[model samples]
Target chain A: MLGPHAPVATPEQLAAAREAREAYRGGLVAPTSGVAHGLVQANLIAVPRDWAFETLLFAQRNPKSCPVLEVVEPSADGRVEPRLAPGADLRTDIPAYRVWRDGELVEEVADATAAWAEQPLVAFLIGCSFTFEAGLADAGIPIRHQELGTNVPMYRTARQCEPAGRLSGELVVSMRPIPADRVADAVAISGRFPAVHGAPVHIGDPGSLGIADLGAPDFGDAPEVREGEVPVFWACGVTPQAAIMASRPPFAITHAPGHMMVLDVPDAAYAA
Target chain B: MLGPHAPVATPEQLAAAREAREAYRGGLVAPTSGVAHGLVQANLIAVPRDWAFETLLFAQRNPKSCPVLEVVEPSADGRVEPRLAPGADLRTDIPAYRVWRDGELVEEVADATAAWAEQPLVAFLIGCSFTFEAGLADAGIPIRHQELGTNVPMYRTARQCEPAGRLSGELVVSMRPIPADRVADAVAISGRFPAVHGAPVHIGDPGSLGIADLGAPDFGDAPEVREGEVPVFWACGVTPQAAIMASRPPFAITHAPGHMMVLDVPDAAYAA
Candidate 1:
């Protein structure tokens, strides 16, 4: 999960990710990421059409974290357009998936073809932290997840996202340790990309966000806070997914954490 | 209808207008310009609660003209709260009102109180053109309606508003002929206040908006195209009203054209 890739490995890795997904359809590679490169990855949220507008409104109100990329319309015949990727079935495109029943994820899935239906459900594509980490590195900012060779650290905060209809919940944010001098630069760099989680919500104190300890993140790996550094927090896209879990409609689907749907749009488009 | 107060009226005239509305619950003081200086005036629309979200989304999608100032929650006792003024009822608040049935104007009433009910419905307060025209004069931009003592010219355009759900229509704009040299200054002046129709949508060429003649507008009076002056169009708040007329819900209520609910908030708040 951690290591710099060869210059050619970027493309090679993306190819391998696609190949893995293909083999995933045939039962090969069991996880995504560590494989894709140059391709824009996305968080996936699938819900019935009846609740599409409320969910969409939730994304709009909590834009910093839940910046939507594309909304794939389910075809009249109950199939996600092959546009997510050619010859790809949403039910089987990723290495892993999670199925939620009445708001609680009941089972992890390898494929959901049997679950695909004629119901007018919608699929939403959201930008992810991985997309921003690429930009941070380009700006000479260090990312903690890459350093630890583990998942990025995320926590539920005291901050609540703007509520819309039935969609409401506390915000979840991801943290990265930043050098004291580079904090401003990191903020300025990320602020330019409003489509992604633009800028830091909190810069210095984890307690200010009701986060008890830096050592205990609600999700992913714990980060090392250096002597002269501070932990910076950015609104995490997972906030909406969490809200969906709480609002639990009859049926909903999301990518299993790290696995993402690579898109035709480039990361550059995510920039403001 | 045309008098010295046509451009500027005293508070007494506005009070009389309000009193007249309370008397028989009716009055029509054409071109509400200068009528209620400090009182909140509102564009009115009444529709069954079932279609509330579509209309709200329509207004949100077309913010330039339909800048909602407030929303009246659906009542359980058939009474609207936060009434625009004392003894002011949504049923009979405004001086003049138009009623639409199945997308057609069925009646023009002096009061609509008879239709009042605990039925679910939502109301919104949109920014009015009067708010911006006042700011323009403060900035030294003499508006034509004030000088010529006439209503502002409003026209329907070829440009379509972004559609939401059941709402869709071409934009309607108010045209003001400004001194040619002052167009840029006028834009910079008005652009600072986006809440009140913001900047002009087009600077010249009425034909571009699908208007066949400048002498005749779909609404309001035409202006003389003075020498060295150009027609400047601003998004009118009427666009939402027009959309409502097109997609007429079974039941809806709106303020008469010029009779508005004067809000406690000042016009200056509309300034960006």
Candidate 2:
């Protein structure tokens, strides 16, 4: 967690984040794990103007899994821009895009400008766990997925999220194996940053959350749980996507899994 | 703050809360400060359906002052019920209601059923600062208003809340005087319950927040500041009303200041 006097974002970090977005806008597609160091990265989800209320209510109801960083309402002229990253087009700044029609993945594209233009889109920028990874590392707690150089393992639990209007789905959680004794430290550190997925939702026993196997996940890469380590689960940003899949909005757009939009704000800006 | 194992609400507390609601429903009009001890109390704001989206977005944007506990959407056939207290009629269960027309307070009534029938209303149950006073008292921090048996002082500040579509206003804050040495302790205690206007927005020197005089507040009672005490201000639940006053919608309803809905849930349910 950042101290009270920490600067939100340094001038150098701001320039680097903008450069990364420019590169993505030019057709670079990849996971954005370490793209813009010290800056915040967000999960993207955009829906039609009519469905925007339910979507916003869903995030407000399930804040643990879907902490909204910013909401960019569709403009009168059909223009959209996230305040988190001013001047960066929401349609093309992300590394990759996933277009959904009737809750199914219709296409994966390098740019979503055409899909976004189909109708007025209300875009939501949601907080990603990547914003709090540095805090855990600073506390001497290891992040298993970062060490293995893979996407964090995620699973869809039996737990049903609070239904909001026409949107409802199971909770999706990302897992990280922590040394047995350091689990408390990990919870304490991450709990300080509620804006970014906060504390672990489940500390052990995946079966309690209805996950059958540790090596097999519903989304992302598999985990490597070693001896003396316990699997800890934090609410994942994929929850909103899970809701989109279940609720089946007629038209929707989101970032391809693990591909995020880098924001100009610093990670400390999200620290509680 | 409650421990992990604390029960949400005792059976006795639930019964007391229900009885209090029944009394209010039977035309007993009064403030709900100590009516049902250990139960949560909330500020009420109901708006027409057309303005619900903008109102919800405003709350989402200004979470500190408008931490929404529950949103009771109008049901088919125009029925309204708040899930916070089952079997409770939102329009008639509250002790008092304020009828607003074009940003003006037209009347204060004991029951709002007649006014509610005029339009489909979406009611918002917002967190109240009374929810955290116990925590402060438990930490040995004095709450000035409680000692003097007066309403907590509230003020409209120079700080502008992040605006949403068609809804905007200056932030309103509730003030409580704390001993100079215990200011930090008060902050740490209240900060635990983010759902209920967490932490102080300003510590001392009310002029910094554009208040010309501390005693003459925009709302609520005049505070009694004693020797060795500093005034601490927190985001007040009345902020949404401030927005209703600033951005006058066609129609609106709210609980009269200091008269709140006593919910069946325990105060611990809101603890972070």
Candidate 3:
């Protein structure tokens, strides 16, 4: 529910976040970065109650793919009494959402209220890179997307996640090419934080992870690999989404790729 | 079972493991640590199929207390289809066992084949410190118990675990007093390995964890705190067991504390 012609600046994004919760009522901001400085952003997933246990099991089985920040399932009154933000409506917090039916993309909507009923829809919010990006920047590790003003490139890898009941898919990774000498530094910096995606799952050699070409990606934009750099891969939060979509649940809702739910919790809370 | 005169030496301990498994045909080398050099060790919990999910959730919610290494509830036999060391019998792997009924201790025996019924009894092999103790020694971190020739001191702290379905209790911690200068390095080293109870849960003052006196522990021997040392605490495996005991399931089986099942998997498998 981002307003047409609303500025896309970080302040605008923050304003959009407030407006979505305050003025627009369940509206979403365009992009979640810049808007909520130093706050934690999360990738959201809403599934039917019947699949809650399976999804949670899948997350547990494949933690690197889905580092769950929190799992919420509201009672009939639509309030997640204990483990949720005040008035935090899962249906409207994020800027955008994707609806899946039987493993197919059915709709991209702002609100999932119509699709949600008394069936006890479970909501899971996963950790995002927005938190780590701030740390990397402070440590002088430049994030390519911010430099190019584009989205980070994501790839489907041969890495297979530990399967758990109807959730199975190839691992997905986001590529951030770092200078060869700085790879150790990057690992040391990111390694300190595991609540968000921890140290690189794969340090070098894209082919070892079944990535064929650096010029192409299954999602997001292509990376600009420098001469002295190697493509470092970190487990992406999308792996669970891919697994759910592949499993083709009867009903599932996820935040649109890259558009996350901004929470009041600080980024430091996510650090293990 | 160990002989009354069993040396209690590492090799003698391993021979005991082999004998226990040999008693059961196609059995394991009696659950593997102290049997083979650098073999992985595990704590076992066997629950009826009906209670599998709840127990697994308990482990998941209280990870430090019940750090699961692997789950083996084979679909066919309703027994733990041993993986790291197949043909191992959960019912008789460890030298000693405990059976709980409706949240109370029912019996302490050497084997539970009599308790085994046709239905599946899900088994969880959780990681034990015996794995990390080797690493700690390899890193030259002096373990007090090794010197004192006694069991590690364990205390039930005021720290409560995140609860899940009929499972929740105050965290039980194993204390290891370390020199003040080595505390930070010890944390760094242990932090690298999350599977083995990760890093120290409480670093400085034990009082913060509601531990009033170091000389007295709820379980195990009292610590002899040396000068220039601070008592460091690691999340103990007893945490989940305590919670399960409080929850009082209809029936449960656990390896007698300290008598772990040795797996064929190497200790390195525990590292991140």
Candidate 4:
């Protein structure tokens, strides 16, 4: 469904999304940004049923960082089909997947069918900031990372998340430099899409969140904070992956950074 | 943490809330409506760890009816302290508790210490309409049930909720008679608190929702539709209870209707 603020996808945009998903399912590995316009791209995380409760609870407790779009419980036959996309098999659809063993990244694979078949895994499709980034760009706010052709800067803050069961970790945030005058506008635009990481958690000072230096981030490329710009920080989706590492679940799977699962659902579907 | 729209609670109101909670813990049995002027009250549901994931997933899928405020995982000693109220025991804080066995209401108890200790129970504190009702009253919208001194009329609708695991049930809604002129005001006021059941689900016709008689309802009292007034329906918190009955978990616990767990957090804490 299209939202009032989001334009309806053109036929070409729809075809691009469908083709991209087909290519990924066919074992093509590549970054997904800018591949499909006006469609929602999701971060994928799958864990065994034994750890699903804790993972789901952790997301519930820290919704700002983990905005779950859908949770796909394996069927009696142990097949997972995310509701966001019909007839799409999660096992092999994402562009790339990271396999973790005891919280350590063991390998990266283009397809995860074999790993998925090993256990009854519950898959979570979490909202990504790409949806709201479109909203921000539409409102004339400059996204520094996009202009620089680099990854968004992410930092691990000193703020401890509300722990759920055994899963606990520090809050992680992604930073974007917005013009001083457009900071409020950027917040209002992104806040409309709460299902994605909504609104800036911190506006002006990174040090306040225990981020020692904005230039040296824990993940992603350094940001370009031009003159007359303020570094605005939004809760990062990496927070859940950080929890998986901190809590050290026996096994887990996630999409490699920048390699996302494109959904059939429109970006506007997540807008408030 | 006072919200801009919400007024700060006076000393007497704060005292009244504290006293009401203490009285309930000391064996007083009464409805909790109007007991606390500006504090938040919550709906309680405690199910064994076996059924927790399904229940939590059900709430996530059907958020409008079952907005979860906090989930309390039992400690090693089997003690549950809801984060909403520090140092408060869920087993004895509420005015009344209902014990369910295989989806059937087996007994109503004043203190649930025995029932709670029967097994490891994970307690979920869900949002209640009482929080938004304060907003409605503040906006000068009349709440008919309050004037009639009867429970809000609730009905089982034809719409089925999105099933989660073993949980599946029809959507249940509460009805309030609002003057046609102020229906917009009522919706706007309540929509501000999404943590509770937010805006009206239906506005004018009962037949459209598959309700045959306004005089009869599946739960709560029949309504008084005055002249120039329309029946407005909202997703009811009773939905989760209906799902519990439909799905028939082996054992469950809930607060008696209209008897709630009072929390220390201000109502504004939940305001958007």
| Poorly placed runs, candidate 4 (over 4 Å) | A1-11, A76-79, B1-11, B76-78
The DockQ values of the predictions, listed in order, are 0.07, 0.33, 0.11, 0.42
- Candidate 2 fraction of reference contacts recovered: 0.09
Model 3's lDDT to the true fold? 0.70
lDDT of 4 by residue, A32-127 (tens): 665686688888889989888888898998888888888987777666787677777788889899888899999899999888887778888887
Q: Specify the poorest-scoring 10-residue window by lDDT in model 1 chain A.
A: A1-10
How good is the docking of model 2, as DockQ?
0.33
What lDDT score belongs to each candidate, Candidate 1 first? Answer: 0.67, 0.86, 0.70, 0.83
Ranking by TM-score: 4, 2, 3, 1
Identify the superior model by DockQ, candidate 3 or candidate 4.
4
Model 3 segments more than 4 A misplaced: A1-25, A33-35, A81-87, A147-149, A177-187, A203-216, A221-231, B1-39, B48-57, B82-87, B113-118, B136-151, B176-192, B203-232
- Candidate 2 has an lDDT of 0.86
Error of 3 at A11 (Å): 15
lDDT of 1 by residue, A167-229 (tens): 788888989899999999988887866666778888988998999988998866778888989
Q: Specify the poorest-scoring 10-residue window by lDDT in model 1 chain B.
A: B1-10
Per-residue lDDT of B1-272 in model 3, one digit per residue for the tens?
11123223345444544554665334332222334545567777877756665666677666666777767655564455566566676766666677877878788777677765635577778777666776676677787876776667778888777776566778888888888888887787777667768788887798989999888987667778899998999888767667767777678888766667766555666666
The DockQ-based CAPRI class assigned to model 1 is: incorrect
**Most TM-score-accurate candidate:** 4
Where does candidate 2 chain A have its weakest 10-residue lDDT segment?
A: A1-10
Give a tens-digit lDDT track for model 2, residues A64-134.
Answer: 89888888875666567777777888888999999999999999999998999898888888888877777
Model 3's chain B TM-score? 0.82
Tens-place lDDT digits, model 3, residues A1-272: 11123223345444544554553233634555444565667778878866775676677666766777777667767754224234567777677778888889888877667666535677788877776777788778888877887777888898777776677888889889998888999888777667677888888889989999978987678889989998999888878778876788888888877677776555665565
At residue A51, give the lDDT of candidate 3: 76
Pick by DockQ: which candidate is best?
4
Q: Give the distance in Å from residue A37's predicted Cα in candidate 2 to where it truly belongs.
A: 2.9
